[model samples]
Target: MRNVVIGFLGTQLDMGKRRRWRPTVDLCRTEGFPVDRLELIHDHKFNRLAHSVKRDIEEASPETEVLLHRMDMDDPWDLEEVYTKLFDFASDYGFDEDRERYHIHLTTGTHVGQICWFLLSESRHIPAALIQTGPPRGGDDVGTFDLIDLDLSRYDALQQRFDQQTREYGDLLKGGIKTRNVAYNRLIDRIEQVAGLSDAPILLQGESGTGKSELAQRIYELKLQRRRVKGRLVHVNCATLRGGTANATLFGQRRSFTGQAGTERAGLLREADGGVLFLDEIDALGLEEQALLLHAIEAGQYYPLGSDAEVTSRFQVIAGASGDLSAMVSEGVFRIDLLTRLNLWTFHLPALRDRPEDFEVNLRHELAQAEKTLGIRVGFNSDASEAWLRFASAPGTLWPGNFRDFSGAILRLCTLAPRGRITRAQVVDEIATLERRWRAADTDQNSQLVAKYVNGPVDPFDIPQLANVLHTCQTSATISEAGRRLFAVSREDRKSRNDADRLRKYLAKFDLSWAELNDG
Candidate 1:
């Protein structure tokens, strides 16, 4: 079967000064070309311009079937969104490798589009070899092309070096955080690779106090160490930038405005001209600001509030948001284009509650941080330390604000500690205070039900099992349902699947019956 070819039409397809035999026609009409069908992806915005080129191809290449697809992209230069749309289209197209071989025409589309196609092909997402068209060396059609595969497997030496560098980057990210969780370590490893190479905008999504700012700072520090950035890191909290001041603070204004200042004030974008710019709480920023930010991020160009001249700021933006951006996009609040740019390299930092394994390691690090920052040594008394660790990591102990709360806990204890030593009294008070706060905030029926049914002073060692039981009970409609949910994964191993009986026995330890617990 003749190889099926897929390509996106760029503006140059018809707008170029060069005469007949445009790249699309040449790719199809070239002598001995093996195109069974040519799939052309075009944006509706350029419908009129694309129509002429589509007609020209049909008239010139009668042998190949030309199929046109209408794909829309808000910005041609925003490859992040462009790739996502194209990848989705390709995925849904569902190529049948058994029936026909495929080839991707790489000469068409924007430079951004071409790069995205190359990346998709490399990852096997496109499932095709590359077909690159160009002007002949001597006197041939410009669209006469050559087929090639990246064949990265052949470069053993380069691959080895890359693997080694990746390991080193991973080590650097974990140097100070002291994280022990395997999944978190892998996440940091991927982050290190992206941080070192791509200058594309990075979005760090998570809860309010889930270390997004700290990670961004570390990324900046890593970039600085590698000589990737020359200037200092500029951080802006979107929550702090409000109303009329938001635009002026981010984009800057000329010194000669109605409320003219003595000297010209550079905006945050300009301040981070050659380094990293981190925007925290990006969900709080205005929609207008997000639109301007899209231009700045995509093209590195933005006009100041009071200036007619456009300014350029080349900086890597690391944005942090606590909630879902897609929901904001649907709500018509956050610009989808801005979110698209930032979504290129998104890394969601798991909240402390999610990664319980890292709690002990992070807790120790927090205390160490207190010691280092305050120039004071504070050690936990044996009983006090045990009690605090047990309560902190146990199930139903909701750490509402994550590490931020944990940090405050350390500070409060450190401040109240007598003679630089934490005692039992302080630990109990801290636990009681935190529990009260979570109880007041947590209105979830499952949460309230768990607290009501579960035994007091949740043991840290039994946290996992207790949590599982509580969750099972909360979700199960009947005692049998809860037992089935718990045993579904392990039923094969158990000789007797006494789901309801098992659930009843377990609830007995908490001084409660299934009928009694179910009512709560």
Candidate 2:
């Protein structure tokens, strides 16, 4: 490992305050990991600290590769430019290997360094370890020295999180898992069939946290493998997109245009060409931006920010929204023409309550994952699981947060449980806490009505007009007689719907129906 070349990109003040470079150099000397080079990247803001560290490094290791990359953390380089520079520099120093062997140690000491670190890791899919600066031993007045320790677990944890995210979101890419959901599955299958193998634009409609972005990623990965598209996956959260100096963030902008000096940056779409472009919370985009996106999807082109150069953006476009884009278009909140362009394909991810069966498997997967992440053991036995199911299946469990809520609940139980084995009562207690939280948010009359409906009358025969009779019978056989009588007309016809069709058909629960509500 002494042959390994390490580059340090962080703050000069931070380096001195935390003693980051000294400890690393010491470790290199002690552990036989040769410190071949040292590059202290700093801005004008840290001029004093930069000069000091530069002199110290020269005295400590005269032969070390000392470079002072002068640029503001924010203005220095965007993620793509950083990748371009780092790879170029690495190649210049003969750091290339057939496999992924070149290691870049990004030290986060300032806001800019942290952002670069996050962006590089995300864009390049590179593995990294975090090292925090600590106080010196028996030093007075917050010792100005960096104590560095490798955060090895961060890599594994990030990988596991990424893996779980892929499975959960990847499942939604095509038509999703049919065995887990009939209504949703059929819709997904139909949509996939409609989308065909061509790179048609896809629009996803659902509330926030419903995994719309995940679905978009899944589509990209699947289509890449299926169609063998030779491009990278690019995702952007439209809600967080900003203009101003951040123009280079979403769209490439001129480096010399601003008072700051830097190189021109590349837009995200350009980097993602040939693969997939996922525009998350697309409804948040202004009308003009929406038009630009529409033109890109339709005409396969767009203009980079602060530039007259028209860049061709020919890639699979997938947009997600929390509300009905069609309605927004009609109400003039969104553009109708743009909506038509996106309506070429649409997929709606069902909420948790809408697909109860998925919960059992999803919950199990979540628990297993949580156990692995937290380094704790946890599981549910038959009785405890039954209790959980009862609580989770109860009415008003729309779980607006969907699988995220389930994951949170399981993780909470794991954290609170004794010796890792969570019981049904523990689940119930958590539910009570959750309910309390809901109640706290329920100050208005509508919330009170919801509270009444969820916690009030136990009307066994209460059935919504849309409730399925077969599903009711399957869930509770005691309601079979009532359901048969309630659907007597259909029974007289001597016809029964298939399982998938059954969900759409009406069934009597607690012997209640639209007529009973009318009578009341």
Candidate 3:
């Protein structure tokens, strides 16, 4: 195979002295590694030097063919210009990998030029290996050369640096909270990647208080830090946008349209121009608004309220929804086309109950934040800390409100602490309050589930039992598991152990099936 060497003409080294072997000429003259062709790149001002170096290469290695290419640059140190020119050159160059091997000579260019070459080659825009030449050692005038292949996996330090950077990005997205849940950490990793790499609309689906809004803000901040965006973040709770004002609030309003003397208002989309727009509770947006948003996202232009001219605002959308958008689309409540655009990068944050391992870590984080906000440090005593830990790790501990409830609990504990020290008594009281709140919520939810299934009025005596049974069935993975738990004590005494049959018959009495309960 033929060998092609591409490099810049070293203005000083390739000129003046024969005693010091020129890097470009020596590369061609190097023993055992013969250059079949040399594609010499240089500024038009250095045309004389390029020809001089070319002549020297021809004399030193008669087998090598030297080709001169004049690439003019105002500032050789300007990275953008150098990269653009080099990228263009690479794009136009005919590469034959099967017949010829390409080598990018790194010793002869400016540092900026060298960096551009590395980037182009690493990204495979230039299909070549990098060859770096140094001064001659021993008897060889050709000098020592090192061939560097841009295989990231071969460089452990570089790979490790990339991994560390990804972890840092994940940490930023998590608001510096030390989370230990494996699934949650993986989710953050994926979000970090998407936030940095893509400008397509992102759909965040999760229950209320699961940090969708917070995550969107973190994504905005990350993109801003990376200089992907220049404008400020615009956060809008779609639930607050209602009736006629919803249109004005999102797409701006003209003073003439309102028949008022006030100045025209730039809406959330305009405010987020060149930045990010976080639409929390996006499912609450009216179908008409959703359609307009879809158009704005796709076209980067929209008609504001009472405005004849179209307003342009190029922004990325990060929408948050507590409910299932797909279900809403099926029910004809949400615009399917809008949902399709936002669903390009969909992420579902897990509920706090599903991420129990992260509860304690997040609790500590909340307490620290509270301390900073309240201007007082609060410490949980050993006994108090243990008590809280037990409650957090307990089986079937419902965190229906997710992180909001957890953070609120920590804030309450800190606020109610005496003299910056939370005692066991305070912890006990907080636990009782949380348990009562959870129980009442569970009871109400269970009653609603019962009402949905049963046709006639349920006997007052049977309400509590029916509610408990329904709650257990919904939480359990299968009828067998539900039956085992519901009849734990009574199952052992039975001669025939058919707990599932007993549970099925009981559910039948209420006109409910396990499948129906779960599907609902």
Question: lDDT of each prediction vs. the true structure?
Answer: 0.81, 0.61, 0.89
lDDT for each residue of candidate 3 in 1-520, tens digit (9 for 90 to 100): 9999899988877884755777888888777898999999989999988888888888989999999999999999999999999999999998999999999999988999999999999998998999998887898555898999897888999999999888788889999988999998989888888889888888999999999988999999899877788998899999999997889889998989968888578898999999999999999999889889989999999999999999999998899999989877866889888988999999999988888788778878988999997899999999888888888878767778888888888899899889999999998888888889988886777677778778899886787799888878866778899999999999889998899999889989877888888676
Model 2 TM-score?
0.51
TM-score of each candidate? 0.55, 0.51, 0.73
Give me the candidate number with maximum lDDT.
Answer: 3
Off by over 4 Å in 1: 1-168, 440-520
RMSD (Å) per prediction? 14.8, 20.3, 7.5
Which runs in model 3 stand beyond 4 Å of their true positions?
A: 1-4, 7-27, 30-58, 62-102, 106-119, 125-127, 131-161, 444-520
User: lDDT by residue for model 2 over 20-94, one digit each (tens)?
Assistant: 435334322322334455555556787776676667666766665556665454445466565555445434554
lDDT for 457 in candidate 3 is: 90
- Which ten residues in a row are the worst by lDDT in model 3? 13-22
Model 1, 348-432: lDDT tens per residue? Answer: 8887877878777877888898988778999899999889888888887768799899999998898788999999999999988
